[model samples]
Target: MGKTPAELSIPAASISTEIPDIPVSIPSQLLERRPDIAVAERQVAAANAQIGIAKAAYFPTVNLSATNGFQTGTLSNLFTTAARYWALGPAAFALPLFDAGARGAQMAASIDAFDASVAAYRQTVLTGFQEVEDQLAALRILEQETEIQNKAVALAQEALKLTSNQFQAGTIGYLEVMTAQVVALDNQKAAIALLGQRLDASVLLIKALGGGWQASEIPNRDKIGGKTKWSQFLPIPIR
Candidate 1:
């Protein structure tokens, strides 16, 4: 974009003025392709993991140790109590019997965090659907407007043709022919601008559809030491 005209070297490309044919209804699962939804889903997972970690604090901790040594390398001496000594015992044990409800409070807070993440994920999904709907509606309306503009352009061109013929016949002045030509040109320009709007709307619709991203690209929770139902984590499926 910053290059000089000589260095630009733009490629040859065809421009399409036709409007795209889009369905009235799209699959809800297509929203899974949205990156925001994916991020929110992962946040929910992380919060769920945090809940488990917090609950672990209520459990006890145990430690064990063992030691064995021989005064002599001889097999006979190894069997003798005077030549060998060994010990095995529980090194430490702790049970959180009383923490003034601190462990309970932590567990509750973690659960609340998980709930919040789930809510956030749902909201993100809703926003994605809204964006898609907005673009689709825009395309539909623009298509209709472009169709009407095309008719106006055709009518203006016909009028300009008639005026030109009258001018050549000397029945109408050149000024009359020029006025008709201006009107035709204006209509043509309006039609082109409408086509541009339709193209813009089409691009926005594709972007709302996640730019071809697939739900399969999302990370699997099963491989991360957990088996969460798809409905529990993401209520929608990848279509």
Candidate 2:
């Protein structure tokens, strides 16, 4: 969409407080959804067809024809007096008996092309798996970091509350309260940044999984306080 983010009607409250529950081991068949894998498979099919064409060159080609009609010698009695007859024979025949060497070379070349296509298809599948694994690993590691950072934020908030109370009672200077405020703010900022990283990882993992995956497959957050659905963050419907 060419529209700005504000035009998309995404609510800030849609942001997930906990990471979505994604499976660590993905099925190999999911890689088939990727466009590059589809293209590579198509190329392999074309190469196999070419091999068939090459093998056909070694076989003989035969052309046959047949005709049946009325035959009469008299022009006036052509329709009334006629004899029924039919003829069938080979009109043309060809067999490259002396060109076996050339045909063999063609067949070899076709086989080579097919092998190359198969290799390319395998490579494409491997690459797709690699990308998905990379994103999954990133999301897993980021989730751990986010959990630890949340604890840090909580501790900072507690510290700030204590410092503010001391300042109000004249037990501490105003400068100490300001320093506590800065530390609490910085921790909150770090927690927010971690959330952003986790969201980014989720998006990339979705992309790597391809469009065929359904939103239902993404497990919702029941362990967390909120029961936010995965579809809330995604703009488009999964196929």
Q: TM-score each candidate.
A: 0.72, 0.71
Tens-place lDDT per residue, model 2, 30-132, is 6666668778887998899899989999889898899877787867766653565678974899888796489899999999999999999999888888988
lDDT of 1 by residue, 140-179 (tens): 7887887898899899999999999999999989899889
The candidate that achieves the highest TM-score relative to the unseen native structure: 1
TM-score (C-alpha, index-matched) for candidate 2:
0.71
What C-alpha root-mean-square deviation, in Å, does candidate 1 show against the real structure? Answer: 9.1
Model 1: lDDT to the true structure: 0.80
> Candidate 1 has which clashing residue pairs, if any?
none
